[model samples]
Target: MLFSETELQRVSVVIKGILTPYVAEKIDKNHYRVRTEIKRPGKYLADVFDSDNLIGKINLHVLSETQKKSGGDDFDSMF
Candidate 1:
């Protein structure tokens, strides 16, 4: 089979033109972010979980008596 290089370039230009800048920017950022996770992996459910303990029994307490969280889980979710 034979193909024309000019036709390929035209299709490429059309595809690039239709993609919005915001969408394109997000895709670019996501591509690079994948690398960081591999370098220094953080907590993952699979890593913490095992056959014997899916959820730690210690976390099942009904109430929290801690001073920081007085009534019902008032835990600070600060980022």
Candidate 2:
């Protein structure tokens, strides 16, 4: 795997502190997919990197009450 279990756990904690939760799903022997939801208002952001180089990011917004209220069970289901 490109990332170790320890690395995934570390990232998960960081994501949770930003007001979202993430579960790391191993995509293959060398890749992973992070699943999460932005459950609050305003912009939500997270960044992934390899050393100093940026690898990925999530920048999302829940600007409407309906959007904030919808489709958030996935976070609870992850546990």
Candidate 3:
């Protein structure tokens, strides 16, 4: 999937909004990827400032329709 400049910007905004409060720091970003350091809240960051904390990582991927539908390892051998 190809995203236009505007579309990518939109995606970035959405991702940033969701991630800013948890990330230790925002490393960098591009159209296809973003890298950052983050740790869990409260216990991990008692008194630290961070853009986003690390509860988990999120990856935005564009998958083909067929791949999305037949997606699984349970039938890998059968396939």
Top lDDT model: 2
Ranking by lDDT: 2, 3, 1
Query: Per-residue lDDT tens digits of candidate 2, residues 30-69?
Result: 5666555655677656666544445566564445666645
**lDDT score for residue 75 of model 1:** 50
**Segments in model 1 whose C-alpha atoms lie over 4 Å from true places:** 1-61, 67-75
Question: Regarding TM-score, does 1 or 3 come out ahead?
Answer: 3
Each model's Cα RMSD = 21.7, 9.7, 11.9
The TM-score, computed over Cα atoms with residue i paired to residue i, of candidate 2 is 0.31
**Tens digit per residue, CA lDDT, model 3, 1-79:** 1122322222322243344532222223423333324332221212122123222234444345566566865677485
Candidate 2 or 3, higher lDDT? 2
In model 1, the Cα lDDT at residue 10 comes to: 12
For residue 48, give model 2's deviation from the true position in Å.
6.0
How far residue 44's Cα lies from its native spot in candidate 1, in Å, is 31
Q: What is the lDDT of candidate 2?
A: 0.51
Candidate 1, residue 6: the lDDT equals 24
